[model samples]
Target chain A: MVKLFAISVIRRPIDGPPDGRCVLLKGSYDLASFGFFQRASVKEFMSFSSQTIVERTSPATRQSVKEQEFFCHVYVRVDGLSVVLVSDIDYPSRVAHTLMTKVLDDFSSKFEWRSVGPEALDAYRDLDQTLAKYQNPREADALTRIQTELDETKIIMHNTIEAVLERGEKLDDLVAKSDNLSAQSKMFYKTAKKTNSCCNF
Target chain B: MSVIKKVHLKGIPFNILPETLLLAINMSPIGGDERNGSNFRKKVVIIDENVAELCDKILQNLSNTIDKDDLLDEFDIIPCESKLNQSPVIHDLTSHKVALESWCVPYLFKHSYHQFLWICRKSRKTSSTSSSSSTIQSSNSGPRRDSGNIASAKREKELSRKLSCLSESERISKGLLLSRALIIINPELTLAWNYRRDFFHPSSLEALEKEQRFVSLVMSRKPKCPEGFTYRKWLIKKALQKSLVEPSRIQDFISQEIDMIEQPIRSYSTNYHAWSYRFWLLELVLTYDKTVVSKDQKEIMLDRELQKSNTWIKSNVSDYSGCHYRQKLLDCMLNFCSDGIPLLLKELDENEKRIFIFEGHESLWHHRRTVILLSINHLKKCKDNNGSNAPLSSEEYGGLEALEKTFQDKESDLVQQIESKNYNDTENECSQLNFKLCQAHVKWMERRLKWDLTKSVHLEV
Candidate 1:
């Protein structure tokens, strides 16, 4: 719960749904409580995080996502390239935003807006390793934290999904209608929420 | 010699019997992508028997490696997966993606893998004189001695067959290491803890200290696990036996222990183990060994706890564990000081802003209910002390009258603000939850106030 669950870079179009299929790096997450099935809830959490980024309206905005116990932070640039960092709620916001801004800037400059090739990806300085490194922010953030003098200016720290959503839009209705999540994931969301089992999920 | 990464002694995930799952940790945050990482492996190959022997060997080797001067911070667990990280160094298993991929864990930690290797080789290598025998001894530490990692498929099959042939006594001999490994992997393994309980010599401070460090490592990964906390309590209980630890150092030892246990409570909320451990420890601190933990020292500890719980509650508006612990702390403090009443009032005053901001949180309301109940008890205490010779006049009573007036006024203001929200908007669910809880609090308070007036009147007559 203290670690970052997943990290992804998405390319959003002005009017259409965002293309978030580029790269998704997951960490060593525990789903031991699910017992029989995998708690790859982080995977579901990853999809949910990317979906939240896709739903954003602002050209350049910073927002927080509190879906159940998970806290996914998003930093969308004016260029439509957004970096998403999904972590446990206890993971600090300051470190998360700093890591995201650095990642987006680095990724934007190094590689063109095309999908990451294995060679192109390997060429970039640790887009993958940065995900693995920042899992324990206390240990890793000190060395890897970019010197982007971010002293908390304009990020809107929304408590829940509804806080960031447009007026009158329900999280449940959006989850039901979204094309990003598969039907099975959508149902699992409902069932997991109903049982209140999503905390570990 | 570098910083010790965490050791996540995890059991290999179920339904897969790969010899061991290798945890490759990056030396630098951004190393040659995958070429460089300290490698270690976790084995959950066979259940209840053969794997026990293998783990016992690795566990013995690992424990001995970690136990030398008890340098825990020197070891780290490997957090990166080996596949995506195709280290030319660990190239063989880099192709075997299924092993690490099938079993997914939440976080990555780094451990002292080289220590394990060094110890195994040292244990095997007596002198410069016979190096061949070293390979045989090293094999026991892992499935293969080639890289200090898991063996290949064909070798793994042969090893499991060989491990099954080991005698029960032989397995039990190294059971100390096996027990620790399994306990760290799956803390739910109660029998492992029970088996290891007698493993340490009672008189040896060194053994207990080593165990204290070991349990701390286990707790870093599994703080919610009861077995780790239970085992820690056992170790402390043993060490606390009159002559076991130095009498002067007992207080220092207990405070250090408190700092160790308190980390999990702050890092992860709703941790009853940390709070319960604190309560149990407090129960000991408050009552036990009067010479070292003096009366005034106990009062200081209670004051410190009140401040801690106050801050803890402010940040965690929804955590019931902190609130409940604060309740116990207040109850204990009342014996030492009458200021629990004012402290309770200050807590309510601080929470007023939080209550206004996060109206839907039930824990906030629940905490308010507890605070009011405690204040009422405190006032009753004041009245009892004053005696029934004359009426318990409001003017003479210490801040009770004003505290009640301030609380009631704040409650009405909160109610008015909550009522103004359009609860008819069915789209917003948390607001509905907030409204219901606020109404319940008001109802509960009205009932308590009525009880308070009647009881005081009865006492006066």
Candidate 2:
């Protein structure tokens, strides 16, 4: 049986069996992860595994998923609950490889979580690269909006400090004047640390 | 009693001079003359020979044709002859037949028969009394009064025509003739001086001199006359355009104009036009010297100027002319020294209220930029002379950084002053000072970028 792994995994009603239902997430590994499981009804798991080739790929997977990598939305009924696994049966083999790599990366890179084996890693890599290639504008737009918000908050903090100093007030008294500034500064410190790590490489 | 006076007796007149006969009327005078038949002697004046002849012929006929007895009994023939322009004058003689002897009267104007006829009727009521009033009244006629009135009107029209015959050149040559007349006629006419300036020809030095004189006169009359200020401005601008072509003539023009502008004491600071001319002069002087002026000498002059300007600003805070001078002085000072940043800051501090201060910090900033470049140049020069001796120490740069901070602080203060209008509206020092601040900011930024500080130094931005 084909399996997927994710940290912070949860189940929800499937909106569709195609591209929209196939959700993609990207972050530092500690933030979030995903996993997949096969149901008992899949009897031909061995044959499917033999047909699905395990592979590795470059991160710059600038292409769409091929048809052979699609996985079935397998339902597993436990007690009174029915859950559908989030993948398409018709996904290309390369997409299966990409998705599998993405799952293993989520587990090893951050908090310990269920690990997708080599076959699923190949599928995840394909899936992530495909999604990234198609969603360049949307990703860039979201990043810009967040950065503008951050810059405005930083300006406000700088102004408040300047005003306090100009008035000959002690810096310690600033907390009583503005809690927003203190919270924003904490956020800035965390982001700075993250940015430092990312930039160092 | 015969009222007429006649004397005919002569000694052997017919035998002595047979061809000539003279009959003379005789009177001693109106003053109690005694004329007993043979002793009477008088002369009667007649109008002229023509009137005298006619009177003589009628008298001879009256003697011969009338019977002597009848003439003697019915008519008292009083001899009368007319005299003109002599005292006690008789004007004409009148006669009638003996039956109408009551109508007979002496007519004074008998020399002309038509005048005699008019006088005869006029004398009828006046013969027994004095007659001069009636004769005086008749001689002055209606046409004479009409003619006199026409002549006066003609004389007035002729006088006006003569006045307008003169051209503008002639009128201006008359020396503030229009404005002076206007002052006399309408002293409140402000535009009279303006009209005089317009009528002045741009090309004529004579007209220019007249314009200057006209303005001078107006300003002399009322030192605060705005029209005088405007004309003075026009003269300066015209002079500038003329001087631009031949620079050698500029000195004379400026000297002449300086006298004109300086003459009015009250308007020295308050007159915008005069102040503008002064500012123009400083600009001209700066522009002329900029190319050839040496740095050390220029700095000394600039320092002197700044000191002089400080005194002026203290006395007359509204003097905007010094605005341009302070700006030029600052530029000259910065150009003079390599380490001029601190000096410039100190100078700016001295006259914190200089109009340039509140102006865009651009000029100040540009001056700062220049100082920075000069510092760099000085560094290069020192390196060229002795690489080891050159002061490339970062501590020196730190000192400059401190100076830069002072400049920024001063600029902020200037901006606040502009915002607050920390100046009397009567004196517009703050606005100009604001512009200098902006100019200083720009120049400082340019200098900072030039020093390659932007690349290595992380800006807070």
Candidate 3:
């Protein structure tokens, strides 16, 4: 079974300096995991994910990552807005990208880029229902099926989390640099490292 | 290998397998899975450690191979057996059925449901006790209470007593607390909101203010919920109704509502509900306390409203709802204008300026059409009244004629602008459509003017 956990849209700076901040316009997580994702830190993680995906992929390309048991797919539009879908590993990457594209198209048609905000997101709450509808792989649209077939030959799969990191860098560096990381996470990492290195209790 | 007679499974609960099989795959490995299989069945021989690992691997393979339905069918397990039994303990199965049932519900929902039930019971108990005490006291006061008049008097006393109890500030506060909790738990619960509404008097400004704050709280949680907006509107109407005695409060209350709407509109420009509520509010303020609101004050308010609408239209040129609202504002202005022609001309000038800037915007053009039609209608009315108190100086009369001539010129100018911009054919089609609409409007205006001229000529003859 394919389980969609969260979907988010982030607005990147268009034609500005590369280091400009990307704003998260709107996001919705599955109701079952809503509380877990509602925390500011988790939202920060989602934004970070979108930002990294945008930086990694060309405007026309899509990117996917396999982290632990979860799969994340990101599609970047030409206008610097990125739609990110995070789901269980069993979810088809092509379907996720297709869903992202559909959402991006629907959203842009209904609302102007300048008018996106928390209140604006209320108008698009039906997007959550779309997420729920596409959870079953059999319900994938024709475009999604075509993309899946094409992706079977050309898609690049990243089997490990390290695919997102630079050569000579570790996942720890990324986590440490992320502003979204809570203080508790840093302490936990330190304690875990210490426990692993030392045999004594 | 030895006979391995009657191998015993240890640690796992007797009901674990059945519960796991009955529930969906997502809810597998219920609570008992937390405890390792360390408890053994009574009177069984121990197996070798290697054999135990082998047994574990075989069971895991079986779980993966056989679906839940097939596994249950092969084991002769009944799905409803656990649910049918309400007992807390089952000795044969060692099942805590009640505990498991409670554990199945989500934590937040369970807690909120419990609180809701507790509040309901508490309120029921209080009402029952109050009613019983009131009856006992009324009976003890006089046996003649059986007569109709005496009974009504006794009932009146009881009602006053109950009102006095409810009127205590603490009682209202408690009701507020419970209602707030309930509303937060489920914003869609209209009954809870209604109960909360009873806690405040319609005329009490302080209570209305508190209710407004409470509404904001609920709105923050569910911004798009119509119920919250409807309640706020109802509150405003109630407050306004009570403010008739003190007309000064009406303006303040209306301004407060405007402030509430302004914030949301800044973020979501096309919120029709917010705009509709604003229109309703303006109507109330204009009509309410006509005796208290002086003519000068009404004019000032209308002018202020006109300026605000102008700003909104400039920012949201394509939002027809805002344009529609501007029509209403202009109508109000015309109704109370000392000299309607000059005001209409000024409005026409403003709208034309907007049209020149936003040439292809349909809503702006439509607004211009409404303004021109209303202006022409006003001029006709003025002529019928023998131009009494007319502000149409010769220069202004020339301006009005110039405005009408420019209306036709504007349409052709827009078509030329669209052509020069080198837009796609589909856009060309749309502009052509707009041009046709403008032509139709101008033709209608001309016919009305000709009809009026013929009537005047016949009258002269």
Q: Which stretches of candidate 2 lie over 4 Å from their true place?
A: A1-201, B1-162, B165-176, B180-217, B220-226, B237-246, B259-270, B285-307, B317-343, B352-400, B408-461
List model 2 lDDT by residue over B1-461, tens digit each: 21322212223212232122212212212222333211111222333333343333333333322222121211211222223211121111222112111001121112222222222233332332466555444453323336667644553344335434655355444324424333312224554545445444567665566546545544433444455565667776776666432454554555566556654533333455555554555455445544443434434444555676555444343344444455555555544444454555555564454333223323334433444344455445555665454433424546434444545555456445544553333233335455445444444554654422223322221
Q: Whose DockQ is higher: candidate 1's or candidate 2's? A: 1
Off by over 4 Å in 1: A1-11, A15-52, A55-68, A73-201, B1-57, B68-173, B387-403, B420-432, B451-461
User: Model 1 chain B: which ten-residue window has the lowest total lDDT?
Assistant: B90-99
In order, the first chain's TM-score in every candidate is: 0.73, 0.19, 0.74
Query: Candidate 1, which CAPRI tier?
Result: incorrect
User: Per-residue CA lDDT of candidate 1, range B1-461, in tens?
Assistant: 22322222345322233424332221112323232122112222222233333233334434544454344421212222333212111101111111112112111111112222232233333332356555655456454455644434444455446444655445444455555655554556676677667445567666677778777766654566777789889989889873577877676677778877865565457998788898888778788667776888878777777787777776566688888998888778766664555566677777666665455677778878887777677667675777342223334443556656766666666666665663443444456666677677666766877523322121111
lDDT tens digits, residue span B1-461, model 3: 21211112235432344343323322423343232211111112222233223223323222222221121111100111123212111111111010111111122222333333334434544565678555554444344345658644554454345334554465555455545544543467676677666555655676576566656544433444556678888888787666632675556667777776664454344566667777888787787667877666667777887888887776466677777888888878777775665666566666655544334456767787787677666655665676664444424646444545444454445435434443343333334554455455445545754422222122111
Which residue pairs in candidate 3 have backbone atoms (N, alpha carbon, C) closer than 3 angstroms, thus clashing?
Answer: B10-B39, B11-B37, B11-B38, B11-B39
User: Which portions of model 3 show Cα errors greater than 4 Å?
Assistant: A1-201, B1-175, B182-186, B202-204, B221-224, B241-246, B340-361, B389-395, B399-461
Q: What's the CA error at residue B197 for candidate 2, in Å?
A: 4.2
Could you tell me the lDDT of residue B378 within candidate 2? 46
Tell me the tens digit of each residue's lDDT in model 2 across A85-108: 222222222223333333334435
